[model samples]
Target: MSLVWGFLALLYVSTDGLEPVPVALLAAFFTIFGAGMNVRLERSLERKGEYRPSRKTLALAILAGAGFLAVLFTGVIPALSRPIIGSFYLGIAVAWATRLILLWRWEAKTKRRIYVEGTWVGSFYLVPPGPLQPAPA
Candidate 1:
């Protein structure tokens, strides 16, 4: 999901000639989309005592949102060109890429086996397989 978002963001930032306001709006939408999916995944993990993003992670998200809010409300971005806004989208793409790597590494280290309903971000668990019970596909 993050990879998809990152790719789309990069494509938009690099190829599109959208104004700063539209770029920022797209950024906001993508942020919400990814964050909501992440939150849903995290809550599922929390319910199963499997995982939770740390306070520092939450703080970083908050700070990023604040930065976007500043740009949205302050009218500073309107003066800037697409390159600047593109840079912001690029930053978001980078962040999502970093998050993907981290989540992959974390999953490897934790030895967790997640089972999702529809997608990787869907509700999942870490239950161990036992006798007479095959592992999830």
Candidate 2:
């Protein structure tokens, strides 16, 4: 991750414009630094052994990351006007909405099991069912 950050920093700083390089370098450097932070976060989560995302959710996350990288590399965010940037953000919002719906459905359908006191508990819902309402009095 640091190597990737170094490469990006080198490329960005080597560009012709020196005036904004300092500010852009700081921003991009920290943003790239987040890749390393994400690794640390994933490791800590794995160690906890209590949280696991569904395969579908993981795949969607990968796709979303790839899509965002594609958008950035295509220069859509930098080259476009404000409305285009807004549209890009609008698309992200739509994607997030779809992801939320899919995640909720997946959670509602999937069951997880954990062992406690040498016995297995097989009923776990990521999205637990809502409380039942009494019949109309």
Candidate 3:
């Protein structure tokens, strides 16, 4: 991941030459950094018996990663804004999908069903079903 980001950074410097889209570049860096953090977090969770990667996780990872790549390479409704797309959009998408994959893995490991009953304002998680909690004004 670091290597990939490094290559991109080098390429960016060579091509754009002092471009002003710092946020987008930072997002790409963040995505790479976040991947390492995710690995460490999952290991810690496993040690705590809070989460475990399963086949479902593999499926989700493949699905999310491939979906993003498909959008990226296949150019299906591709982001025409070239600068923002590769750096900002892909970075955010991959990072977010990583988070979701972790959450889903945790739920799969814990036998917890996490979902909304309607609004997240009231009681939402539907496991061990009970009366819905009163909604806030």
Per-model TM-score on C-alpha atoms:
0.41, 0.27, 0.36
Best by TM-score: 1
| Positional deviation of residue 16's Cα in model 3 after best superposition, in angstroms | 8.7
* Candidates sorted on TM-score, descending: 1, 3, 2
Higher-TM-score candidate among 2 and 3?
3
RMSD in Å for model 3: 14.3
Candidate closer to the true structure by lDDT (higher is better), 1 or 2: 1
Better structure of 1 and 3 per TM-score: 1
**Whole-structure CA lDDT of model 1:** 0.57
Give, for candidate 2, the lowest lDDT window spanning 10 residues.
115-124
- By lDDT rank, best first, the candidates go 1, 3, 2
Query: lDDT for each of the candidates?
Result: 0.57, 0.40, 0.51
| Clash totals in order | 0, 0, 0
Model 2, residue 30: C-alpha shift (Å) = 14
lDDT of 1 by residue, 1-137 (tens): 54564466567546645566665665666566656555556566757755544567667866875786577446676644645565565556654554455456546655555554433233345657666456545
Writing each residue's lDDT as its tens digit, candidate 3 over 55-118 gives: 6755775687567556655656434444444454345545656655765776566654445332
Off by over 4 Å in 3: 1-22, 25-51, 88-137
